[model samples]
Target: MAKTVGDFILERVQGWGVNRLFGYPGDGIGGLVAALGRNDDLEFVQARHEESAAFMACAHAKFTGEVGVCAATSGPGAIHLLNGLYDAKLDHQPVVAIVGQQSRSALGGNYQQEVDLQTLFKDVAGDYVETCMAPSQARHLIDRAFRIAKSRRTVTCVIFPNDVQEAKAVEEAPHAHGTVHTSQAYSEATVLPQEVDLERAADVLNAGKKVGILIGAGALGAADEVTKVADLLGAGVAKALLGKAALPDDLPFVTGSIGLLGTEPSDWMMQHCDTLLMVGSRFPYSEFLPETGQARGVQIDLDPTMLSIRYPMEVALAGDSARTLKALIPRLKRKEDRSWRGEIEQRIARWWREEEERAMKDAKPVNPERVFWELSSRLPENAIITADSGSSANWFARALKIRPGMKASLSGTLATMCPGLPYAAAAKFAYPDRVPIAFVGDGAMQMLGVTDLITVSKYWRDWLDPRFVVCVLSNGDLNQVTWELRAMANSPKVPKTQDVPPMSFAHYAELLGLKGITVETPEQVGPAWDAALRADRPCLIDAHVDPDTPSLPPHISFSQAGSYAEALVKGDPDESGILTQTFKRVFS
Candidate 1:
């Protein structure tokens, strides 16, 4: 049989080194599905929904430095991919989404499952989104999507109409006026700032006695450079949530995550520093940073648009984080005064002790902080960790101590829910030998994680090492929002909107032929993780943690405290537990 456009599309993506495509089956994409079945070079991962598939693709790009690809049928399936694609776009992951459209002839007729896919994908895939009107258009569309996605480190789209997908393949475009030729070749440029700018940044750093370094996801590859710079300047380093794994938490001068889910040491470092250097991170909270002009600032990022957006910088270096830091290191003068670094280390040590004390405090049942804190010590070497939004993110951000070589991430800019399991699955696919763990809340588990468990069961047997674990904080409440109501809105928890229905996630995992463990007490948290890690297959730990455990910010203001008191006075449903837990956390 002669090759079709569908065949060429798959072949081209495979040529670009895409080993797997994540999507669900639908008739609109029947041609591509058939072609996929015939081809053995690419693997098709069947996700429960298009959203999960997109999340998987985004995670694939994040875990591995490759362009992630996801496919879906037209209409609702295409719409479902928007949230996950936005996650990729906002977090700056390279992902290409290929969606099927209705027959080309029926596009404007408003046929069944026909939607304006071009306009629908415009915002998320703004860098590039094109429809393949003919077989001749397939090659360039596929090539451009992958190239642009990789080059821009953002989401791109290619729409394939059902009719066009089944048309005969156009392996090469004709050498004519209207025809366009494209190549699959792409290489990352070495982005470096001018020498004058690097020297200026170094001058600002050397001038100050108290220096602070803040890094985000962009600093992932420049860990050594960041460390050398930090050590030379006798500075403290704080990680943005997305850059948690950029530096190991064991470093005394390395403060943990910064922001609402941040540590006291990081907040202190930012508040007191006279000089600040921000690398490869666009952490959105300005209040968490030093007051404008309080500190002389230098910012570094690959994307010029992101430079100096968060903080007013004296020097804005538009270049790759690693390379820029490497160039700046030599110009920097080592600070002989070790007082600032020593002070920062003392604060970090005290903060960790406080964190341990907070985690061990008694609660109604299991304390959620305890769950993550226990897991931190038991995490296998080189394990990949993913967390969902909500209270789980709060704990994952604060309690977990990410060591060197362990990879960790979540929905950073989007802060969306339900990517935990999908990300872990993608990480496992990227590195089948490494353990992948997910920390999720009951709400996210029900929304998406439960369904993705079946995806895990189906693929775990083929993995070189099958030690995937999903740790579900089964607190029967939308815990994060519930606390936000009390602390931010000055309102009591409205059980109608905030309570999550109780379900046995462990039992659900068992039903899918995976190991399941239930942990109701704090003592069982550590043992359960051990069992899950040792299990021959994927495991789910249903940890029934206390909903009243508050995720306190590093610096709580008077207004926030007053709001919490007012909410309690208004008669919260979990008033007693909240009071008890809050007292222990704050005063204990």
Candidate 2:
């Protein structure tokens, strides 16, 4: 039998060291699916939907630093991949999406499932998106997609028309004028700033009495360097949400998360610091940072464009986080003043006590903060944790204490929902020996988590450790958006839009032949997690938490307070509970 274009593409991807492809089956991609079946080297992970597949690919890239690949059919299946691919693009993860197109002859004829895939993928896969018009084009398209996705750390796409996919494969391009030759070779360069710039950045840090260091996802590999710099400069370190695992939370001068879902110590450090060094984080909220001109600023980022856009830096070094910090550390003089570090440590200690007090506050049933706080102490070493957007993210940012060696992330820039389970599953696949836990809300669980559970049930038995746990906060409300209406829009929550329909997520997991536990009281929260972690298979914990428990910002402005008052005056459906919870959280 002659090798087809589909078979050749898979062979090329396997050559690039991709061991798995995530996607769903469809007739448009029948050729590729058949080729995949024939190939034993590459495993195909079947996701419930194309969106989940894309998310899995994104998470794969995030967890394993490799180019993740996902495939789907034409039209709706291809469209479903957009959101997840955008999440990859925004968060700067490498992902290659392979989608099927209709027959070439029927492309312009508007045949069934024939959408303009090129234009559809242009925005998400803006760096590269091309169609394989012939067997000869397949090699270059596949090569370029993987290379560009890996080199650029963004999403890339390759569209395969149904007819072209089944055509005879062309392993190599001819050495002619029109033919193009490409190879599956890419290597990440170690970027470092010039000595002159590193010295200037060091000078700025040395001159300041109170220095603050901000780390983001870019600093994940530079933990030791960041710590050395912090200790030498007597600086307090604050983490952006994406960089939660960049540094351990147990450090004395390490303030927790920064920005809206930040800790008081982080906000305080930002407000009072005399010099600020921002590393590999584009945290988006300028108000949360030190006021302009009040502090000397320096920033380091691999992407030159991201360098000084968030905060104006006197020295903007375009380089890798670990390497830049290492170069800068040699030039920095150790600060003898220990007063600032001591003050920051005191604030952090007080903040944790406050967090504990807030988490333990009584609510209608289970307090959501307590769920995460309890999990923080029980998180297994080397565990990978993912949280969905919504109230779950609020608690994830504030309550959870990420220790060293534990990997954690979410849809950082996109802040999208329903990626938690998919991310965890991808993490488990990447490190079969490590446990992966997902913190999700009922709304997200209802949206897609429930269906993805079957994906877990199917794959768990093969994993070295069958300890995938999905912790669902069943609050019966779209709690995050509801609070945003009151705090941001100054409007009362409209029950019709804010309320979520309840579902038995635990029961659903049990039906899929996985363990299930329900926690209706605060006492059950800790025990439930213990049970789930010990289960022989994947487990789901349905924690029925209070809907009115406030996800308060570290510090509230007068305007936000005014909006809350206005919303309450306008008669919010849960005004009484909201007021009570707000008071308890504020005064605790």
Candidate 3:
């Protein structure tokens, strides 16, 4: 039997260790679909929508640290992948997308389902994008796509025309440069800094009496090293949202999260530190950062491009997180005075007390924090959690405690909705033995949660375990946007635009042959979580939380306070009167 270009592409992808491809079937990709059916090594996950497939691929890469792959037909199918692909690109995850195109003979004819994918994906896949024009080009193009994606930690796109995919492979061809059948493997190598760089970083740390550390997802494997460095320098550590798992919450001097959705102590630590050591993070929001000349800085990143991009650095060390920390630890001088660390720890303790107070509030309806606090206590040590954007993210950021073994992920860069459910499904597929939970906003859940629950039911028994839970924070409003309207602008709420109809996501789950639980009060939150965790199939928990609870920053500016005041004066319904409730929860 003569092999086709599709055969070669699948073989190369399998060789590179991609065991699954998430996509939807369509006419533009019929050839590739046929090829996917022939390859037993690759399992194709059929999503209800191409967008969810792309989101699944992005989540898979985030969890496994490998180049995740997704496929789609050209035109609309390819366009549907943009949102999730952007999620991967912005977060610096390795992902490869394959899109089907019209036959070469029909080029520029405006054929049915024809579109220019290269231009469409240029921004998202700036690192690599090309069409497979011939059978001989399959091996080189596929290998290069994987190589660039893994090495650069960016997205890569390959467009396959229908005719080209069906073409028979030739032993010798015009496009052939080398052996077409040879196998090659590639892996990202550890990057380390020079001795001089490490010494300079140590000098920066040693000169300051009060040092602070900002850790990101790049520092995931270097928790011990990061703690050692912090202990040696008497530094308080603040984690970026993506880096929440870098250190356990129980660590005394570590602040949970930074920026708008951050703890009060983290903002204080960032403002007061004389020197800042940044590892594996290119955290934006320079407004939250120390002012110019406020602190001497040392930044360590594997990508040289990211070093010192956020702030001016006295020393920039380009290296792997664990290796760089290991090298620099030996040259550091331990601080004798533990007062700074003690003060920061005290602030952290106070912050936790505040969080607990907020969680324990007995508002008329239900406090959103109560649900997260219950989940925090009930979550398995090894659970993988996903949070959708909006108020749900604020609760997840502030309330959850990410232990050393646990993993938490969000659309940090894209900040897109409708990804939480897909992310949980992907995590469940990737780590079947581990529990996967999605903390999703009512808006985001209504957008795709029910549809993806069907996908979950389809693949539930395909894996070793079926323990997936989707927690819907149903407040019947776009709570975060509403808060933004009140907190950022001194305007009355746009009643029609911001409010969502009350939805029964739990009932929707049950309709799809899955378990469902609805919690309207504080007491029901814990028992609902308990039921979801014990269920053998996927479950949904619909939590009716207070919509008026404001996610106020630790340090609210005068202007922001004025804005909130103005909104309250200008006919903003103090309906649940949760503003006073929330105010006391934060200040009192």
Query: Can you write out model 2's per-residue Cα lDDT over 475-583, one digit (the tens) per residue?
Result: 9999899999999899999989988998888888889999999999988888998898888888999999999999888889999999999999999989999989988
Question: Model 1, 558: alpha-carbon shift in Å?
Answer: 2.3
Model 3 regions lying over 4 Å from their true place? 170-183, 574-578
Choose 2 or 3, whichever is better by TM-score: 2
TM-score of each: 0.99, 0.99, 0.97
**Residue 186 in model 1: lDDT:** 81
lDDT (Cα, tens digit) per residue for candidate 3, span 1-588? 577787777877888889989999887787888888788878888988899999999999999998889999989999999999999999999999998999999979988978888899999999999998887777777888999999998999999998888888643345445545433577569788999888888988999998989999899889999999999999899999888878988788888899899988889988989999999998998877888799999999999988889999999999999999999999999999999999999999998887888888886577888889888878886999999999988988889988779988899878999899899888887898999999998888778766888999898887787788899988888888888888888976887988888878888888888899988888888899999999988889989988877777867788888988888888886534756776666667
Per-model lDDT:
0.93, 0.92, 0.87
Q: Rank the candidates by lDDT, best first.
A: 1, 2, 3
Each prediction's number of clashing residue pairs = 0, 0, 0
Question: What is the C-alpha lDDT profile of model 1 across 493-528, one tens digit per residue?
Answer: 999998899898988999999999999988898899
Candidates 1 and 2 compared by lDDT, better number? 1
**Candidate 2: segments with Cα more than 4 A from true spot:** none
